[model samples]
Target: MKTLEHIPLNGELPSPKGVALAILELCRKDDATIAEVARIAQTDPALASRLIRQANSAAHGGGRPVASVTEAIMRLGMGTVRNLALGFSLVDQYQNGPCGQFDYQGFWSHSLLMGLAMQKFSNMTGAGASEELFACGLLAQVGRLSLATVYPVEYGRLLDGQDGVARNLVALEQEHLQTDHNELTAALLGEWGIPGALIEPIYHHEEPEHSGFSTGSRPYQLVHLFYLARRVADLGLAGENERNACTAELLLLGGRIGLDAEQLGATVDDLVQQWRTWGELLRVPASALPSFAHMSAAHAMRDEKSDGAAALRVLLVDDDPTTRCMMEGVLSGALGHAVVCANNGREALALAVETQPQIVVTDWMMPGMDGLDLARALRATEWGQTMYLIMLTGHENEDEVSEAFEAGVDDFLVKPVNVRTLRARLRAARHYVQLLEAWERDRAQLKQFAAELAISNRRLAHAAMTDLLTNLPNRRSGMNALAKAWAASSRFEQPLSVMMLDIDHFKRINDSHGHAVGDTVLRDVAQAIQQSARKDDSMCRMGGEEFLVICPNTDLKAAVQAAERLRRMVERLRIQAGETEIQTSVSIGVATREVGMTETDALVNAADRALYRAKQAGRNRSCVVVQGQMRCFP
Candidate 1:
């Protein structure tokens, strides 16, 4: 933060006025107390009433509403009161600034929405004090207002000169004026004694990707929250076309932080309502906007014809082999989705890294990783954060269901896995994925931002369903992989096979070395598995040191050949340890679906039995089970 001494602003920077000025000054003194600040605040009836009313707003008030200035100040905290005064004072004094190109009213409206949005988000995420974040959001972009106030003519000329090429406003500001709004905003916030923690995220909120905060850290969450708040504010002030143009990205921004589409919509609607209430209190203009669902539908409806056209990549997880087969059939055969299956949460997690499924349906209770744990794990990853998750459970406990939702399960399925209910839930999930897919296609055409008039108004290209690709390692997509393979085999009467790979003596390695080295070897081997995998081979972790690779349209010879290649690949990996290179190898078990094989479970069982044979025949070898006969290859 630049000291006020070095900012080099010729005109007066934006500051609190009259009663707000008095409160600010009183609080600046080391000996000053809330009593002194409240006494000054009481002098202005409007300011006092606003403060008292805010103290009693739903966010702050739980008991009897505060009836006095001192009570409100004490309740809202000194820092929050001071910041609110500064924000309200600026709105009062700068309702109409001298900058002709700047929309003074629009700025406040947008800022108010941002304030409301931030407050609502904080409450939802337990990020911070609601009122403090509300005020923080309200004044997050005061630097822009500071610029307009300090260099009215020059800034207006700079704004007008944009001519719609989509140049960055910060760059444009520095080009015309020596300083930009972000710097000025930070300085002003610093001078006003707002904590550096909030100011830092606010400063980088415009392009939070550059903030350099570690992923999942508080600063990272706060910066992204600010960015999302700004997007909500953008949507609030946007024209219909502009709102439609930006909703997809807004959804992505929300999803990046674990908000599924429906939750995001409800939060937006709630914040918009609060924006109206706060707008009235602060005397800033607020306008009615359509609900988030409406805006999303408006944006993607034109591409509706293609919404169900593509086969969605779905990950299905269930501990029961019977249940897994049933759901896989429903998801793949009935719903026309490409499915991947995981028997446990552990395997699902590994596959999630590889396949990048758009949807995940998992059983709540499993041996290793339960559905809720899987949901939380998926939500924690960057790419998995947005993959729609549905929990399949036999329990009807409402508390358990609530726990599941809180754990980040987007939706859930009751026992017996009602196909109709599953379909309905997936329908909503499909809509979200479609909207997400639309965002991916249109992201390049959209402007970097939409806050200013100088932003480009480019025509968005029609939507296309490009495959959802992330850094895949792959998905716990349901047996759709196996089911589809089965469908293909049944359709063409082709061969189908599945291979099981187990890291030989993994527990011994962990026993010999610390778990750190074991972990390193494990990660290296997973990477190797990914590197050696064929595009058509669907691979998933079956359990500790064990993996399942489904080979479709391949005979026993071809499947054995693929397994040999993967075996050699693993054997070649000399994973680097602290002082030594740790060599690891895998034992393979291969099984092919034979004639009259009706249950997909049999293929997996055969592979598992063969895996035991490989281990029993001395580790680091391959064994194949064909019908009732067995063949071993070392």
Candidate 2:
């Protein structure tokens, strides 16, 4: 897991901005009042409205609707309102950014469901404060969003592998980005000053049972509830088999908390209805789900089809032919998978590497090499890292079980295995294999998308810096290059010169022959200027009728010669526009940075003043500024 320092402090995650920043500053004061929070909330009317609506949502227990920010803060408490404002503010600001892999709409939808589920589950189980739990559920997955924001392109690839064999998202994140969402979420919640009561449960929600807290403790129970809420959110968004799997998981979770199947089913139906209303208020997507009992019934209708095509290659190994044949018959018949049988562990390892099977089921006590040895060997290889390995053992010793797992066995089956148990385990393995294949396909597609996005970004950057009319650097780009040249000159004690040139009496061409003629003259003059400029000079269009030339490492005399050359070329230039033969001349001004000038802008202003002097002296000549005095050059 990554530490707080691993997270980029440079606006990578959703920290408070605008009104949210103001509210947070006020929150830092221990004596801040409801009116103060309300005042800050009202500064962003849209965020203020969201806070009021959230305070009255069913997740918070629907009651008399509040009419003002002050009323909402009084009802929801200052802390809850502050957090809500922060959440809404981030939602508004980052709904669309560089995270192409992140589904902004789906994120909010899932969070809203989790929030509603947390509140409902806590109310039924009496696990934690409903209001606080609601906030916890809403922000539970925010760290994932933060990761996407910080590393948009890389995170998109990580999210693509989310459904692969690695079921633990945190583990996958740690492997790839050297950080996990759990640590990030906990760190952010702590920074926000949320009570540990809420933060600890969210930190461990991913593996609630393994969290150090005692099973019946408040933190443990809350963790379990949060996990259940995540499943509910998954069920709410899932379709087909995914929905059934989540329903099965939710049923088991509800049982642990002493809620019977029927009670949990009805409660979820009510929650879904309320979630729809809240989703509209939050402007997030929410689909209506049938009662949990109904979804469970759908699971029954689909169970046979679920095993239709596991599609994964299975490698089955056993020392005895009879046991090997029996296992092969069941797995191939049930899953309709292609099965390869090996009588010994050594042969199994060779076939596994050759065929690259998605799953391997081997007996624990094979001759020469045991299942543990085979599993360990396979895990040491690249392809074997993702392969699902299951050990079949009659030994019920706890130490042996731990050793098998440490050897990379995904699951273990007692020998004389019940056919029903074996079939169920195979089905689970099939699900994992399918997910891995899907992830591989998604990774290919996302890689292509990233390549295309990179190209588009480059085109956009080029367009931003180049002027469309003449295909030259625009004023902004020119100014940036000038600053760099100035810095280089200052460092080397060399002079840098600038020339500002404008077409003399150019408006007459536009007014007499139309602006189309004026455009033609401008294009022609720009081309002539480029043809005359030295290789080291930078040319830019300073918008209609004016241009700038930057000459680095050149003193005032050389700059004056370059300006006169450009002036003579413009006078000799001729442009034909719609039967009108146009002749144009330019007035030039030259300025060079000397001892007393400390800024690039000062040099540019001096050049403009010289250009004004040239225009005053005559419309088609060059003027150079020397020692703060303008001298005309014929």
Q: In candidate 1, what are the lDDT values of residues 508-585, reduced to their tens digit?
A: 888988788777776776677677878887766554677778888899999898888888899998987678788899
* Model 1 TM-score on a 0 to 1 scale: 0.50
- The top-ranked prediction according to lDDT is 2
Measured on C-alpha atoms, candidate 1 has an lDDT of 0.83
lDDT of each: 0.83, 0.84
Q: Which 10 consecutive residues of model 2 have the lowest summed lDDT?
A: 1-10
lDDT of 2 at 36: 83
Clashing pairs in 2: none
